[model samples]
Each structure stands twice: as C-alpha cells, then as structure tokens.
Target: MAEQPQEVDFALAAYREEGVWQVQELAHDVLENLEHVSSALRRFPGDGGAVGMVAYDEDVFLLVRVAGPTVRLLLSDITAADEWDLARDAVEQLGLPYPEEDDDPAPAGDLDILGDLGMHAMDMGVLIDDYDLYPDEMLSDVAGRLGFGPTFDDLVGLTSA
Candidate 1:
C-alpha cells in the first residue's frame, strides 16, 4: 500500500433514473479501493445501477459498474498495479496476476462492461489503445458515446463556461 493515497484527477458516478442521465462528482477518498467505489455507487438509484469513473495520477483510470450484488471493473492500465493500490485491488478482483514492470500497458478486466449501455467491447478496446488520450479524455469520449458527454465534461471541468 502507498504511504499516501493516490491523487485523483476526478471521480464520478453516472447513472440513469427515469430516463434521464445524472452525473455526480464522487469524493476523492472513494479512490481508496474497489470496495469504496462500489459502496459509493450503491447510493445512486440509477435504472441500471451506477457506473464509477476514476482517473488517478493521470497514469491510469478505473471504471466500476455496480448493479445489485454484482460488480464489474476495468482498469485502463494493468501495469499501474505496480504503484497504485486501487489498480492492484482491481487486478486482484479480476483474478489477474500483477504485471512485470517491463510489460506493456494494457487494459485489464471487463472490456464489455458498458456493452449494455451501447459502447461495445471492441470500441472500448480501441479507446484504451489510444495512448495519445489521457484518462479524462478517454472517459469523456465514453460519456459522449453513452449519451452524457456534456454533463460529464462540465463536472470534470472540461467544458468552457
């Protein structure tokens, strides 16, 4: 575990209720681990459960979907486990071994996490493969495809007033 908690660029929970999408800014402390994210997400009354998007240290991002007792996760960079406790917890939850420091940066866990919401696994993979984009950018693109880009952008301060 790190002596200091990881810095979060942003942590948000998005869910749809009554046919409307709602985005909420999650507290930075939710980035502690998967359990915290899941617990926080359960508070939302989203029609299909709630989705959590957290970007840490600008090095990796974690997406968590909590519906009922089921929780699915996706970490943008598997190798991040080497330095981040949240990523390590994610890798463990996915039943994956920690990657070697020299291993290539790859996304791990449920690639089809958002399939039901309309972002297919193939497209998700493509977005993860785009190294040019930061975690926030990738997540913003995801929000757009899922029909809540503007709300996500505004919450993350990506939108100009």
Candidate 2:
C-alpha cells in the first residue's frame, strides 16, 4: 500500500493588500486547530478579505474564506470527514454528521468560500465534482475564478509550462 500522506500538507492564505494579493503559508500544526488558523489569517493586513486553501495530500482539501468577521468553509470529502481536525471542525461548523469508514469520499458541504468574490455556489459545485482534477487544479480553477489564478499559481510555485 502507498504510504499515507501527513494529515495536512500545506496551507496557503491570500488576501488583497493595497490592490495586490498578499500570500502566506501556515504550518501543519497550525491547521490541526481552527482558532489558530483564524488568528493567523487575521494578521494578513488587508481590507479586501482573505481566502485560504488547505490540502491534505491526495485525500482531501479545505477552503476557507474570511471577510470581516464571517468565515466560510468547503471540505473536499465528507467520507474522510472525521479523519482530520480540519474536516472534523468543518463538519461541526456545518452541523453535519461524521462519515463512517465505508463512506465514499464525495465532495461534501458547500463551496461558497468565494461567493462574495463572484464565484457562484453552483459553479463551485461543478468544479468540486470534477473528479478528474486534483486539489491543486481545482484550487487553481478557483483562483482563476476569483481573478488571482496567476498570482496564486506564482505563490504556490505552480507553472503552466
């Protein structure tokens, strides 16, 4: 069997600062809890709102958006719902039932992380359902939708070449 990846791979947090996108990353331990992630994101220094994406290797992905005091979340798989703290917190945030071991890793919860930035909920659903794409690609699509594809790609060191 392939070795399982660590629960949290990496997290990217970005927000518009003075008309430019400012991006930063968080450690895995920080993602093991929600309040820590919140505290970290709030320090980005931006009035244009903040958006973040956390990928748990090939298993799952979590998207978080903070606009002022409101925080929104999107988890890629509900089957692995209770497997990690981020997923567990997401379930609690949505008041969702924890998925069992036999459950399929279907995209769960909603993807309104960028609704205020112009990504429609229905469109996010479609992107989330495109199983052919991996977390980075899906997030890249999201970045594109949010008008930060290149900037985000650059921050994450992803190149289309």
Candidate 3:
C-alpha cells in the first residue's frame, strides 16, 4: 500500500480555520484542493484539471472538465441548512442527472459561493462568467431602457458591497 501525504490535509485544515470563513478564502481553498486532486488524478487514466469555486448562494463547488463540458460538484456552503436542500430539490424537479459513477469524474453541482460573499445571485454568475454580467446586447438594451450612459472598464469588479 502507498502512504498518502498528510501535508495537503494540514493545509486544508488551516485554510478552513473556524470563524475565518470568508468567501474568497473558501474559494481559494477549493481551487487549491481542485488543483491538488486534478494533478494527482493526472497520473491515472484521464485528464487532470478539475477546478473548484464558490458560486451565488454561499455554495462551494468543484468543477471538472469532461468530454468538453464543465461538470459541477456541491462541496459545502455557508448558507442556511435548508438552502442546499432546496437547491437539490429544485435540480431534481428540473430533471438534471446526478453523476453516474465515481470513476466517471464529473463535477458535483452548482453552489452559491456568491451568497457567502453577500452578493446578489446574478453577481455570482458575473464572477464565474468571466466577469461580464452584462453581455454586449444586454448592456445595450439595459442602457437604452434605463436611459443610462455606457461605462467601460478593463476588468470586471467583484467587490462586496
């Protein structure tokens, strides 16, 4: 049998320190874990590049690319206990399929890391969607509808309000 390294678990414990559960910290930890797992998995059969992030509802998730698609995994959340239950129920209602097998290696599910950071749900999508909440058409339409002038910036901002 091979002995696994204890160092990663030690770092994970440190990263998830109690009362220090900021969303960014959580996301960074998730990402680190993802990189670790993906790299380890690379020594095996499939590609090794799974990634993790926190999404709109204080949800921590793992995302893995498979067959050219991104799969999600819901790891943890800082939201109400019932929130995850509700999301899972909604997904079942929507007929989304659960992962097929452990070896299949797909992402878990959508998580609400955004809510953990106190941002609106749409803001979570903005963060993951490459920081562009308003696409070109949507931006133009909203600007026209609200009679607002166009504003442009180099990078999309994700600061908590």
RMSD of each: 1.8, 3.2, 16.4
Q: RMSD of model 2, in Å?
A: 3.2
TM per candidate = 0.94, 0.85, 0.23
Task: Estimate every model's Cα lDDT from 0 to 1.
Answer: 0.90, 0.74, 0.28
| Candidate 3, superposed: residue stretches over 4 Å from native | 1-18, 21-95, 98-108, 111-114, 131-161
The regions of model 2 sitting more than 4 angstroms off are 1-7
- Per residue, candidate 1 scores C-alpha lDDT tens digits across 1-161 of 44435477888999999989999998767666789889999999999899999898877899999999999999999999988888899999999998997999999999999999999999999999999999999999999999999999998889723
In model 3, where is the ten-residue run with the lowest total lDDT?
6-15
Measured with C-alpha atoms, the lDDT of residue 112 in candidate 3 is 42
Residues forming the 10-long window of minimal summed lDDT in candidate 2: 1-10
Query: Count of backbone clashes for each model?
Result: 0, 0, 14
Query: Sort by TM-score, best first: what order?
Result: 1, 2, 3
Q: How close to the true structure is residue 40 of candidate 1, measured as C-alpha lDDT? A: 94
Error of 3 at 37 (Å): 8.6
Q: Give the alpha carbon lDDT tens digit for every residue of 1-161 in model 3.
A: 01212111111111112323211112222333344433332332222222222232222222222212333333322121233332343234335553333333222244342233233345434443442332322222222222221321111122222
Candidate 2 structure lDDT = 0.74
Return the TM-score for candidate 1, rounded to 2 decimals: 0.94
Count residue pairs with overlapping backbones in model 2.
0
